[model samples]
Target: MADDRRKNRIFRGSLGLLLLSLVLSGGCWDRRELETLAVVTGMGLNYAAQGDGYEVAFQIVRAAQLQSASGGAGGGGELKPVWILRSTGPTVFEAVRNATFQSSRRLFLSHNQVLIISEAVAKGGLLPALEFFVRDHEPRNTQWLLLTPDEPVEILDAAAGLERVSALAIVDLMKQYQLTSKIKPVYLADYIKTRIEKTTANTLPIIRIYETAGKKELLLDGTAILKEDRLVGFLDHKETRGLLWVLGEVRGGVITVDLPGGGKATFEIFDAIPKVKVEFKEGRVQVKIEIKERAGLGAQTTYADLSTPEQFKKLENLQTKAIEDEIRAALAKAKAYKADIFGFGEYLYKHDHRTWQRLQKEWERYFVDAQVEIKIEAMVEELGLVTRPATYRELRK
Candidate 1:
């Protein structure tokens, strides 16, 4: 009876220990509650005016204000949906951690949508200021990367027309880039890939503030060209689209051309495909860019019936010339900068490794003097509901 009693006591002790272990390991030890985190929607990087350190800006969405804006229980006027928190340090990692001094909750960056880099920082070098975002676990790699001549913090603080958060609004702008095909959207991962490439250069969309009639707004204006991780020059909207054309990223946009007789015709670009061939002849590098494009007659002020074969053929020719002109303009600017934003060097590396190996050392010099030929085949596939200009038809009647 005494031995049985001792066995029962040992079994009971083992059961108690097992229950305790289960209770201790049931939940995550490092789990944080939602209310303890400050959700960051946007981040901006700029140079600190006082020292050689960096300034980081975090746009934190105010949850209560956002709820109120969405018809939650709020009696008074709407409050600003985001709080712009700024901090500075000698390094980006330190700068990010310093934000905790001003913020009550831990800053969470998983939801960050956009990263704005100042012109000053971009001109100096992007890698130094961008190392933290690239290496950090919290910040996502898919966030849109933008460059701004204006203050990045100010850009984040600017008003968002539809979205309560300016970062998300900027995301929307990037999504609609296909509609215009004039802006190039670069993600953090994409930027990193370009930065690591030996022959290829990088470009980021330029965002700035526009004010009129006592109201301020954000607009994507142009493209910032980066060579060797430093800003070399910029491409205006027209030239930007030209770059997009060579990259075959043009989805939908309008092309307006003047007619030989009078007025102008607008063609809505339905699709565009580009074929680039890099040839090495007699130790000389040449690039041939051929573009195949399909468009429709969106609007015309000319009296000619563009639906007919003769008139349509002329229209096609004009469209082709216009596209070629854009491509040439972009090529001229890129060569002037001696920046290979077209990935010609990358193409050589992939297709002709031996040639790339020979020219890899002085690729920039070769690129500056390289011969580029452009050919465009544009077809106007649709003429819309009417054959000719409505006004012209009425006048004929």
Candidate 2:
């Protein structure tokens, strides 16, 4: 037994040594030089008006220009952010191959951060248009998906930032703003799943790039509402926040409430908890949304005293009312657009498939008319600094 064990150990050690030797001698597989690889930071899909098929645009990052572009250089010396390459074909794969007409090395998309779909291409049905992305093995699944009113190719070219181009800026925005803003970061996988599981309802963050207001910036505001993978309408910034509140994704944002007279006191929502309850009566379904929140004093333009517990309670009530107002407004707009971005339809489908089938055909209709009761309950913990005697110094006196 001892002899056999020694032999087995020797064989294992020898095999490990051989593998290490092979790895050390081997070279990188499918390795390409940085200059050879055209870094694809963003992809745009648009409709070819000529009826040729789909229009695909690649945002090729220019490293040479970007390297020394930020050294207090004027616009002339600044780097060209993206070299636009266009192709049209029956499918994304074919279009990608066609893009080689203007390139050399294989176009790499794994590092891509955003995918923009034009209104025309998305209206045709985003699922089929994006099937290539979902089914193909190129694009990252976590890529941020966006919808633009103009051709997506425009956004890819509208690189405007001191540090990085639009694509890199977008990648940073998604990472940072999520912690402090209620904008739901739209990912490619989430959007596709949202369409498949529910009544074809989802939202994509909207981005627009234009040399307007004396500045060129890639602005992402509100959300593009989609019903069955088609553009129906859009939500304003506040409406987007409300949608996030419904989705239980509210983290931190400022909520301003009007006081009794004319002053407006704003509170920063430091924490938020959304409670949604679904009930079924006979064959009908009802939803109750309870948005509970805790906030701190962000602004106090009102002369109202917030030192007392009663004063804090009043402020909490005021904030709650403001939150409810925004929620109602967002819900009304969503219903009018016939877009179920709140995923209420999805919840119904998951819990009760039978009722969902009955409601699927007219889910939008029911959603528009369905009685959704909303209740907001908020509390104020701290008023920034002094909450004991600042409001009424006379009490201390």
Q: Which pairs clash inside model 1?
A: none
Q: What Cα-based lDDT does every candidate model obtain? A: 0.92, 0.80
Deviation of model 1 at 276, angstroms: 1.4
Q: Which candidate is the best by TM-score?
A: 1
Query: Which 10-residue window in model 1 sums to the lowest lDDT?
Result: 388-397
Question: Per-residue CA lDDT of candidate 2, range 237-323, in tens?
Answer: 888888888888888888888877788887888878998865556555588999889888877775667658877888888888888
Model 1 alpha-carbon drift over 4 Å, by segment? 1-28, 72-74, 391-397
Cα TM-score of candidate 2: 0.86
TM-scores, each model vs. reference: 0.94, 0.86
